[model samples]
Target: MSHVANIMLSVDPDDRPTVESLSRWLQTSAPLRGHGPGATGRVGPLGGTTGEDTRRGDGGFPERDVYAGALDHADLDELIAHVERLAWRQPEFVHLFVTDQEQSSFRVWRFHGPKLRQISPEGREEEVRPAGGPPDIHTRFALAGDVELLRDMVVAAVNWGPGPAAPREAVLSDPRNAHYVDGWPRPGDLGLVALATREVDRWEPAPVGAAWLRHFTEDDPGYGFVGDDVPELSIGVDAAQRGRGTGTALIRRLLRTAREAGIERVSLSVGRDNPAVGLYTREGFRLHGRDEGEDSLTMVVHLR
Candidate 1:
């Protein structure tokens, strides 16, 4: 059997130090030629198809495609454009390994025809179709709890992994949310719960709803609500008040707010085994995903 190999180094325009470092590393690690500073060079065995044959000296390894050194913002844009051009010009190059020393993240993207596929470190695979649109990236939060919750979240996060899964426990222990002290909202309990972009225009709260807000304020005090582009809906009721329907009312208020703002969808995470899951489901929330450590279900509701 005969195989061909080609190695290419793509660098950002602003990172000269990285280019120099990589050049030295490649020189010592493999057979390569030194080009000028911040320049690409090629190295290879004379002529061999398979890597095994190249190792045996039947032929040398493949030549590398050298481009400019590390990239900057402008260079990154140029590089992406160049890659897209290559995809159109030469469709045979299927595998691309991208390393960003600037960002300290490495990604391997595979091209099949016009489609790109990203394989996550967790072994999840997501596809990017060229015709449909650009690639989509997401930020994932791990919900941790005790041993039992962790075990459940892990099973739900991925189907397989060793050890107990405790995403919430791990998160709470990380000293980030550790300083969180539970208490009642004093006189200045007037904190803002910024609505998400989708919720901003839809729902309106009645002045009388202030009394209803007491449930979320009194029980889930302390953590001021998040104010990001994607608003998180989190509600908690006092342990003693569990069966009294406080949670249900709080969610109803939130849904009302979302609807008033013209937001059609809302989502939240609750432990899978928790009774709250049933409440959400009964109220028209559908399970979207699961987190084991929190033993939670990521649920979403859509209002017409």
Candidate 2:
């Protein structure tokens, strides 16, 4: 059975970029079927494969429309020839966005670092799997409200590299540990927990944990404080979830969130012992400074 992914877009009436346009924002250009002459760049309005309107918001200012379409199943070799083949692209995610809508834009979230299986409203499943994709799993997201949950994540992030178990009981007592979840859901604070419900009766969490950012003033800066304008990033997944490319998904989603929030960059501090440093490097974090006598490194990801 085919499962459909829905995409919503806000577009201006003129020269809007759509799936049909094949604008290739991050990926390069390729021949696409849905584009036509004299048609504004949007789904149905252009040509070829198009999206059906599930919901249409008022046409007044920032007109928004809900669109649902089938998952493209072009073979990976052919797909990669035209696009960069991002790690976050997956079988279950709807990667559609208003590629270049004039005067308006929406944040596009990547939900499929590990290709996920979807249960449609009609209960059908997406049958095609990408050639080298990860095992199919059901994905979930939630707010990091519970401090206990935040604490577990805190321990994970602090002890990221391969080594002895870092003390969890008194982890938060240290100023360094407190920096990550200290303000715990402060105003403008954002967090997203990753969960999977494939193997167990309930959602098993921490596979690729949450990515969080907190902005602090000079009066009280976190250990990784870059500036008042840049949010500091703290992320850690359970030991069970390491090395599966799940961390990449979490970081990209956090980057999307930061972009949506108008943040220019996000920063973090990590030690030399951490293996996960490569993950941040792959996601575009640059070394900004060193902490703790060269034992730790400070990094930042520019959103703008």
C-alpha positional error of residue 40 in candidate 2 after TM-score superposition, expressed in Å: 42
Best by TM-score: 2
lDDT of 1 by residue, 204-295 (tens): 21011111111123333323221222233444332333454444544554565456656666555555566667888987988664444655
**How far does residue 71 in candidate 1 sit from its true spot (Å)?**
70
Query: TM-scores, in order shown?
Result: 0.28, 0.54
Compose the digit string of candidate 2's lDDT tens values, residues 1-304.
1121233422322323343343342123322222222222222221323234433365333333233332221122222232223322122333333211111222243233443222231212111221222343222233545556777888887776667867997787887678667657777687655543233422222234666777877888887787888788877776776676556666666677578778888888777667777878988998895455688788988887
Off by over 4 Å in 1: 1-230, 289-294
Q: lDDT value for candidate 1?
A: 0.36
Each prediction's RMSD to truth: 19.7, 13.7
Residue 133 in candidate 2, Cα distance off native in Å: 8.3
- How far does residue 168 in candidate 2 sit from its true spot (Å)? 1.6
Model 2, C-alpha of 144: deviation from truth (Å): 5.2
For candidate 2, list the clashing residue pairs, or say none. Answer: none
